[model samples]
Target: MFFHLNLLSVFRGVLYSDNSQGQDGVDIYGPIDGGTAFSGIQCKNRKLNLIDGSPNRISNIDVQSEIEKAKKFKPALKKLIIATSLPKDKAIEEFVRLQSMEHVKVGLFTIQICFWEFFERKIPEFETVYNWYVKNEGFHRIKQLSVTFKDGSVEMTYHPKFQKTVDRYIIPPTNNTAPDINPYTSSLANLLQSDINKMMQPGYNSIFRSTLLLSNTIDWEQLCWLELLVSNIGQAVVEDYKIELSLEGFFEKAEPERGNVLFNPDFHNDIKGYRNSNSHLYIEPRKKILVQGDSFVTGSFYIQPAIAVEAEIKLNWKLLSRDFTDSGTLIVKIVPQYHVIINRHEVLDSTDVREEISYSLIKRKGTYNIGSIDYHDKESDYPVS
Candidate 1:
């Protein structure tokens, strides 16, 4: 309860939780800025102790001693409070009033014996945020970070991280003649694909010669240096604040074939990556910033395209806050990029193309199955068709 209450104190802008422990007789202390009037709080969850000789449910003498210990705190407290979970009776309340008058008699200052009922009436939401902090960040929470940049561009992407990790596997072909992939077989189908890539250089092969048009699937296990830029374009708004970026249910496991950015060209090695790391930035007014660091490439959804050769663009963003969160998404048609090499060149030449075609048809237009996809200019019609 002490730890959570201090966390709540920091969240509400009362004080930052960077103080000494309660062993020195001070559990909660005001911020160094000393902005708020209230100075210290001694949170104690003591219940009524039933002693043999004691007729009273509460002990005023023990409470007074606790208050005395509080006075020994360095940098004299302005308003010392005895916040307790147990309720105070008429006897205890009267004793506290009389003790307040005896400032010289007792070294406590303006003592307020707060009951558990006080939180129920005032500052009710404190408990809720405290519980949430404990569940999410827990004892060691991620400190608030500041992100600043004129252009909101996430500079580098390294690895992909999420709540869970799962590997991406390629199901191979069962038979050498099969056109479709077989989950049970090696993705290579046989030793044929390995030989095809070796037969000729990447671009001159009978396969989707161009690396951009190689793969059958337009998929990305990771998108490096990819970050969503956020701008607060609004009507004359001036607020000095920061925001935290977190992705839930967003993940992608790295594949050796898909590969990753072993070294970040954009930022230093000590920088953060999108995956398994915190996404935080401080936006100044209408300015923008690039949310870049050491992390796995974030935001992954393997979208299956309707057309074989079609562009697929996906964008997702969220405006988060302590209260409510607003988000938006946009998906635009984009030209898919990939690399593919046909292991069975004889089958494609016989079934797909009846007549012989030039490398321009294969290189520029990619492998054609339907009507001879002849291109006017190698540059103009190359990857478009």
Candidate 2:
């Protein structure tokens, strides 16, 4: 007697029986009383070994045998679920081949291939298959693809056409929300804010204000040079003055004190009381002057403050004479004489006067003494007390 059964009921019963322990071993081949009979069927797992020695292709014979076996159970089978650990490409090829056969509906074949095994050592292959399934899967497509790396991470959603298919196979959405990304334009805004912060600093503020107020009058090249100087030498303003200045303020303050000429470019003007004497000399003959002379002579000379007062005359002189015409010659000599003037019959002495003297002659001598003289005349006598 021919018997028919619902495919859903048979498949459900088989799955349930496989999950639970069967109580009886009785071989009840035909349908039970008042129940529809089903053609007993067998479902087996197919293992495909792509790496080691094994058949690389699925043969037609094997396909035919499975087809025949499936035909017997056709009355009770609504769908065929095939699970394999085969590579994705092989699994897809086999599924396609099977679907091409007569009486094979594409919807009836539900094939599952493990991603870990299928994509092993073949990332490009996996991507190709993933894209294909996303494009063509009837009810299976990528809902979301997340890619992460050490540098950055990205996640993308598939287009609407594939959303339905993707929803069928994708993992259920989690309770956790997706992370928020900073907008591309927001990055530029942040950079602008940083620049504003820099412009707000005291020194920078001064410079920016000055630049804006005097933009039309200031020379661009000079401003650029000033900017460079401020950047390098302006660090001192922050260090010593307890004021933060921009490169402009630094350069403005650092540039050789205005109206002061730098005869020596290598001179340091930061130290206290250190004057650039290169700009302070005038040629004058001795007016009762005592010159402390050095041995050799050269271009110009510099005398510091502490020694300037010891010399009798004004402490400003430069030997503009490039020729050493005055070397070993008497620049000036001190005449040893004392003068006394009586104030109300009390003699006032001038011997107690403190003297400081400095002279800049040729550069041949590194240093000179306080008493060196080119000429001393003891024969001539002047009035004394």
| Candidate with best TM-score | 1
- Global lDDT of model 2: 0.26
TM match of model 2 to true structure: 0.17
Q: State how far residue 279 of model 2 sits from its true place (Å).
A: 91
Worst 10 residues of 1 by lDDT: 157-166
How well is each residue in 260-350 modelled by candidate 1, as lDDT tens digits? 3454334322122344433222112222222222112222122223222333333344333322234444343423332222222333222
TM for every model, in the order presented, reads 0.27, 0.17
Residues 72-94 of candidate 2 have per-residue lDDT tens digits of 44344333333222334555556
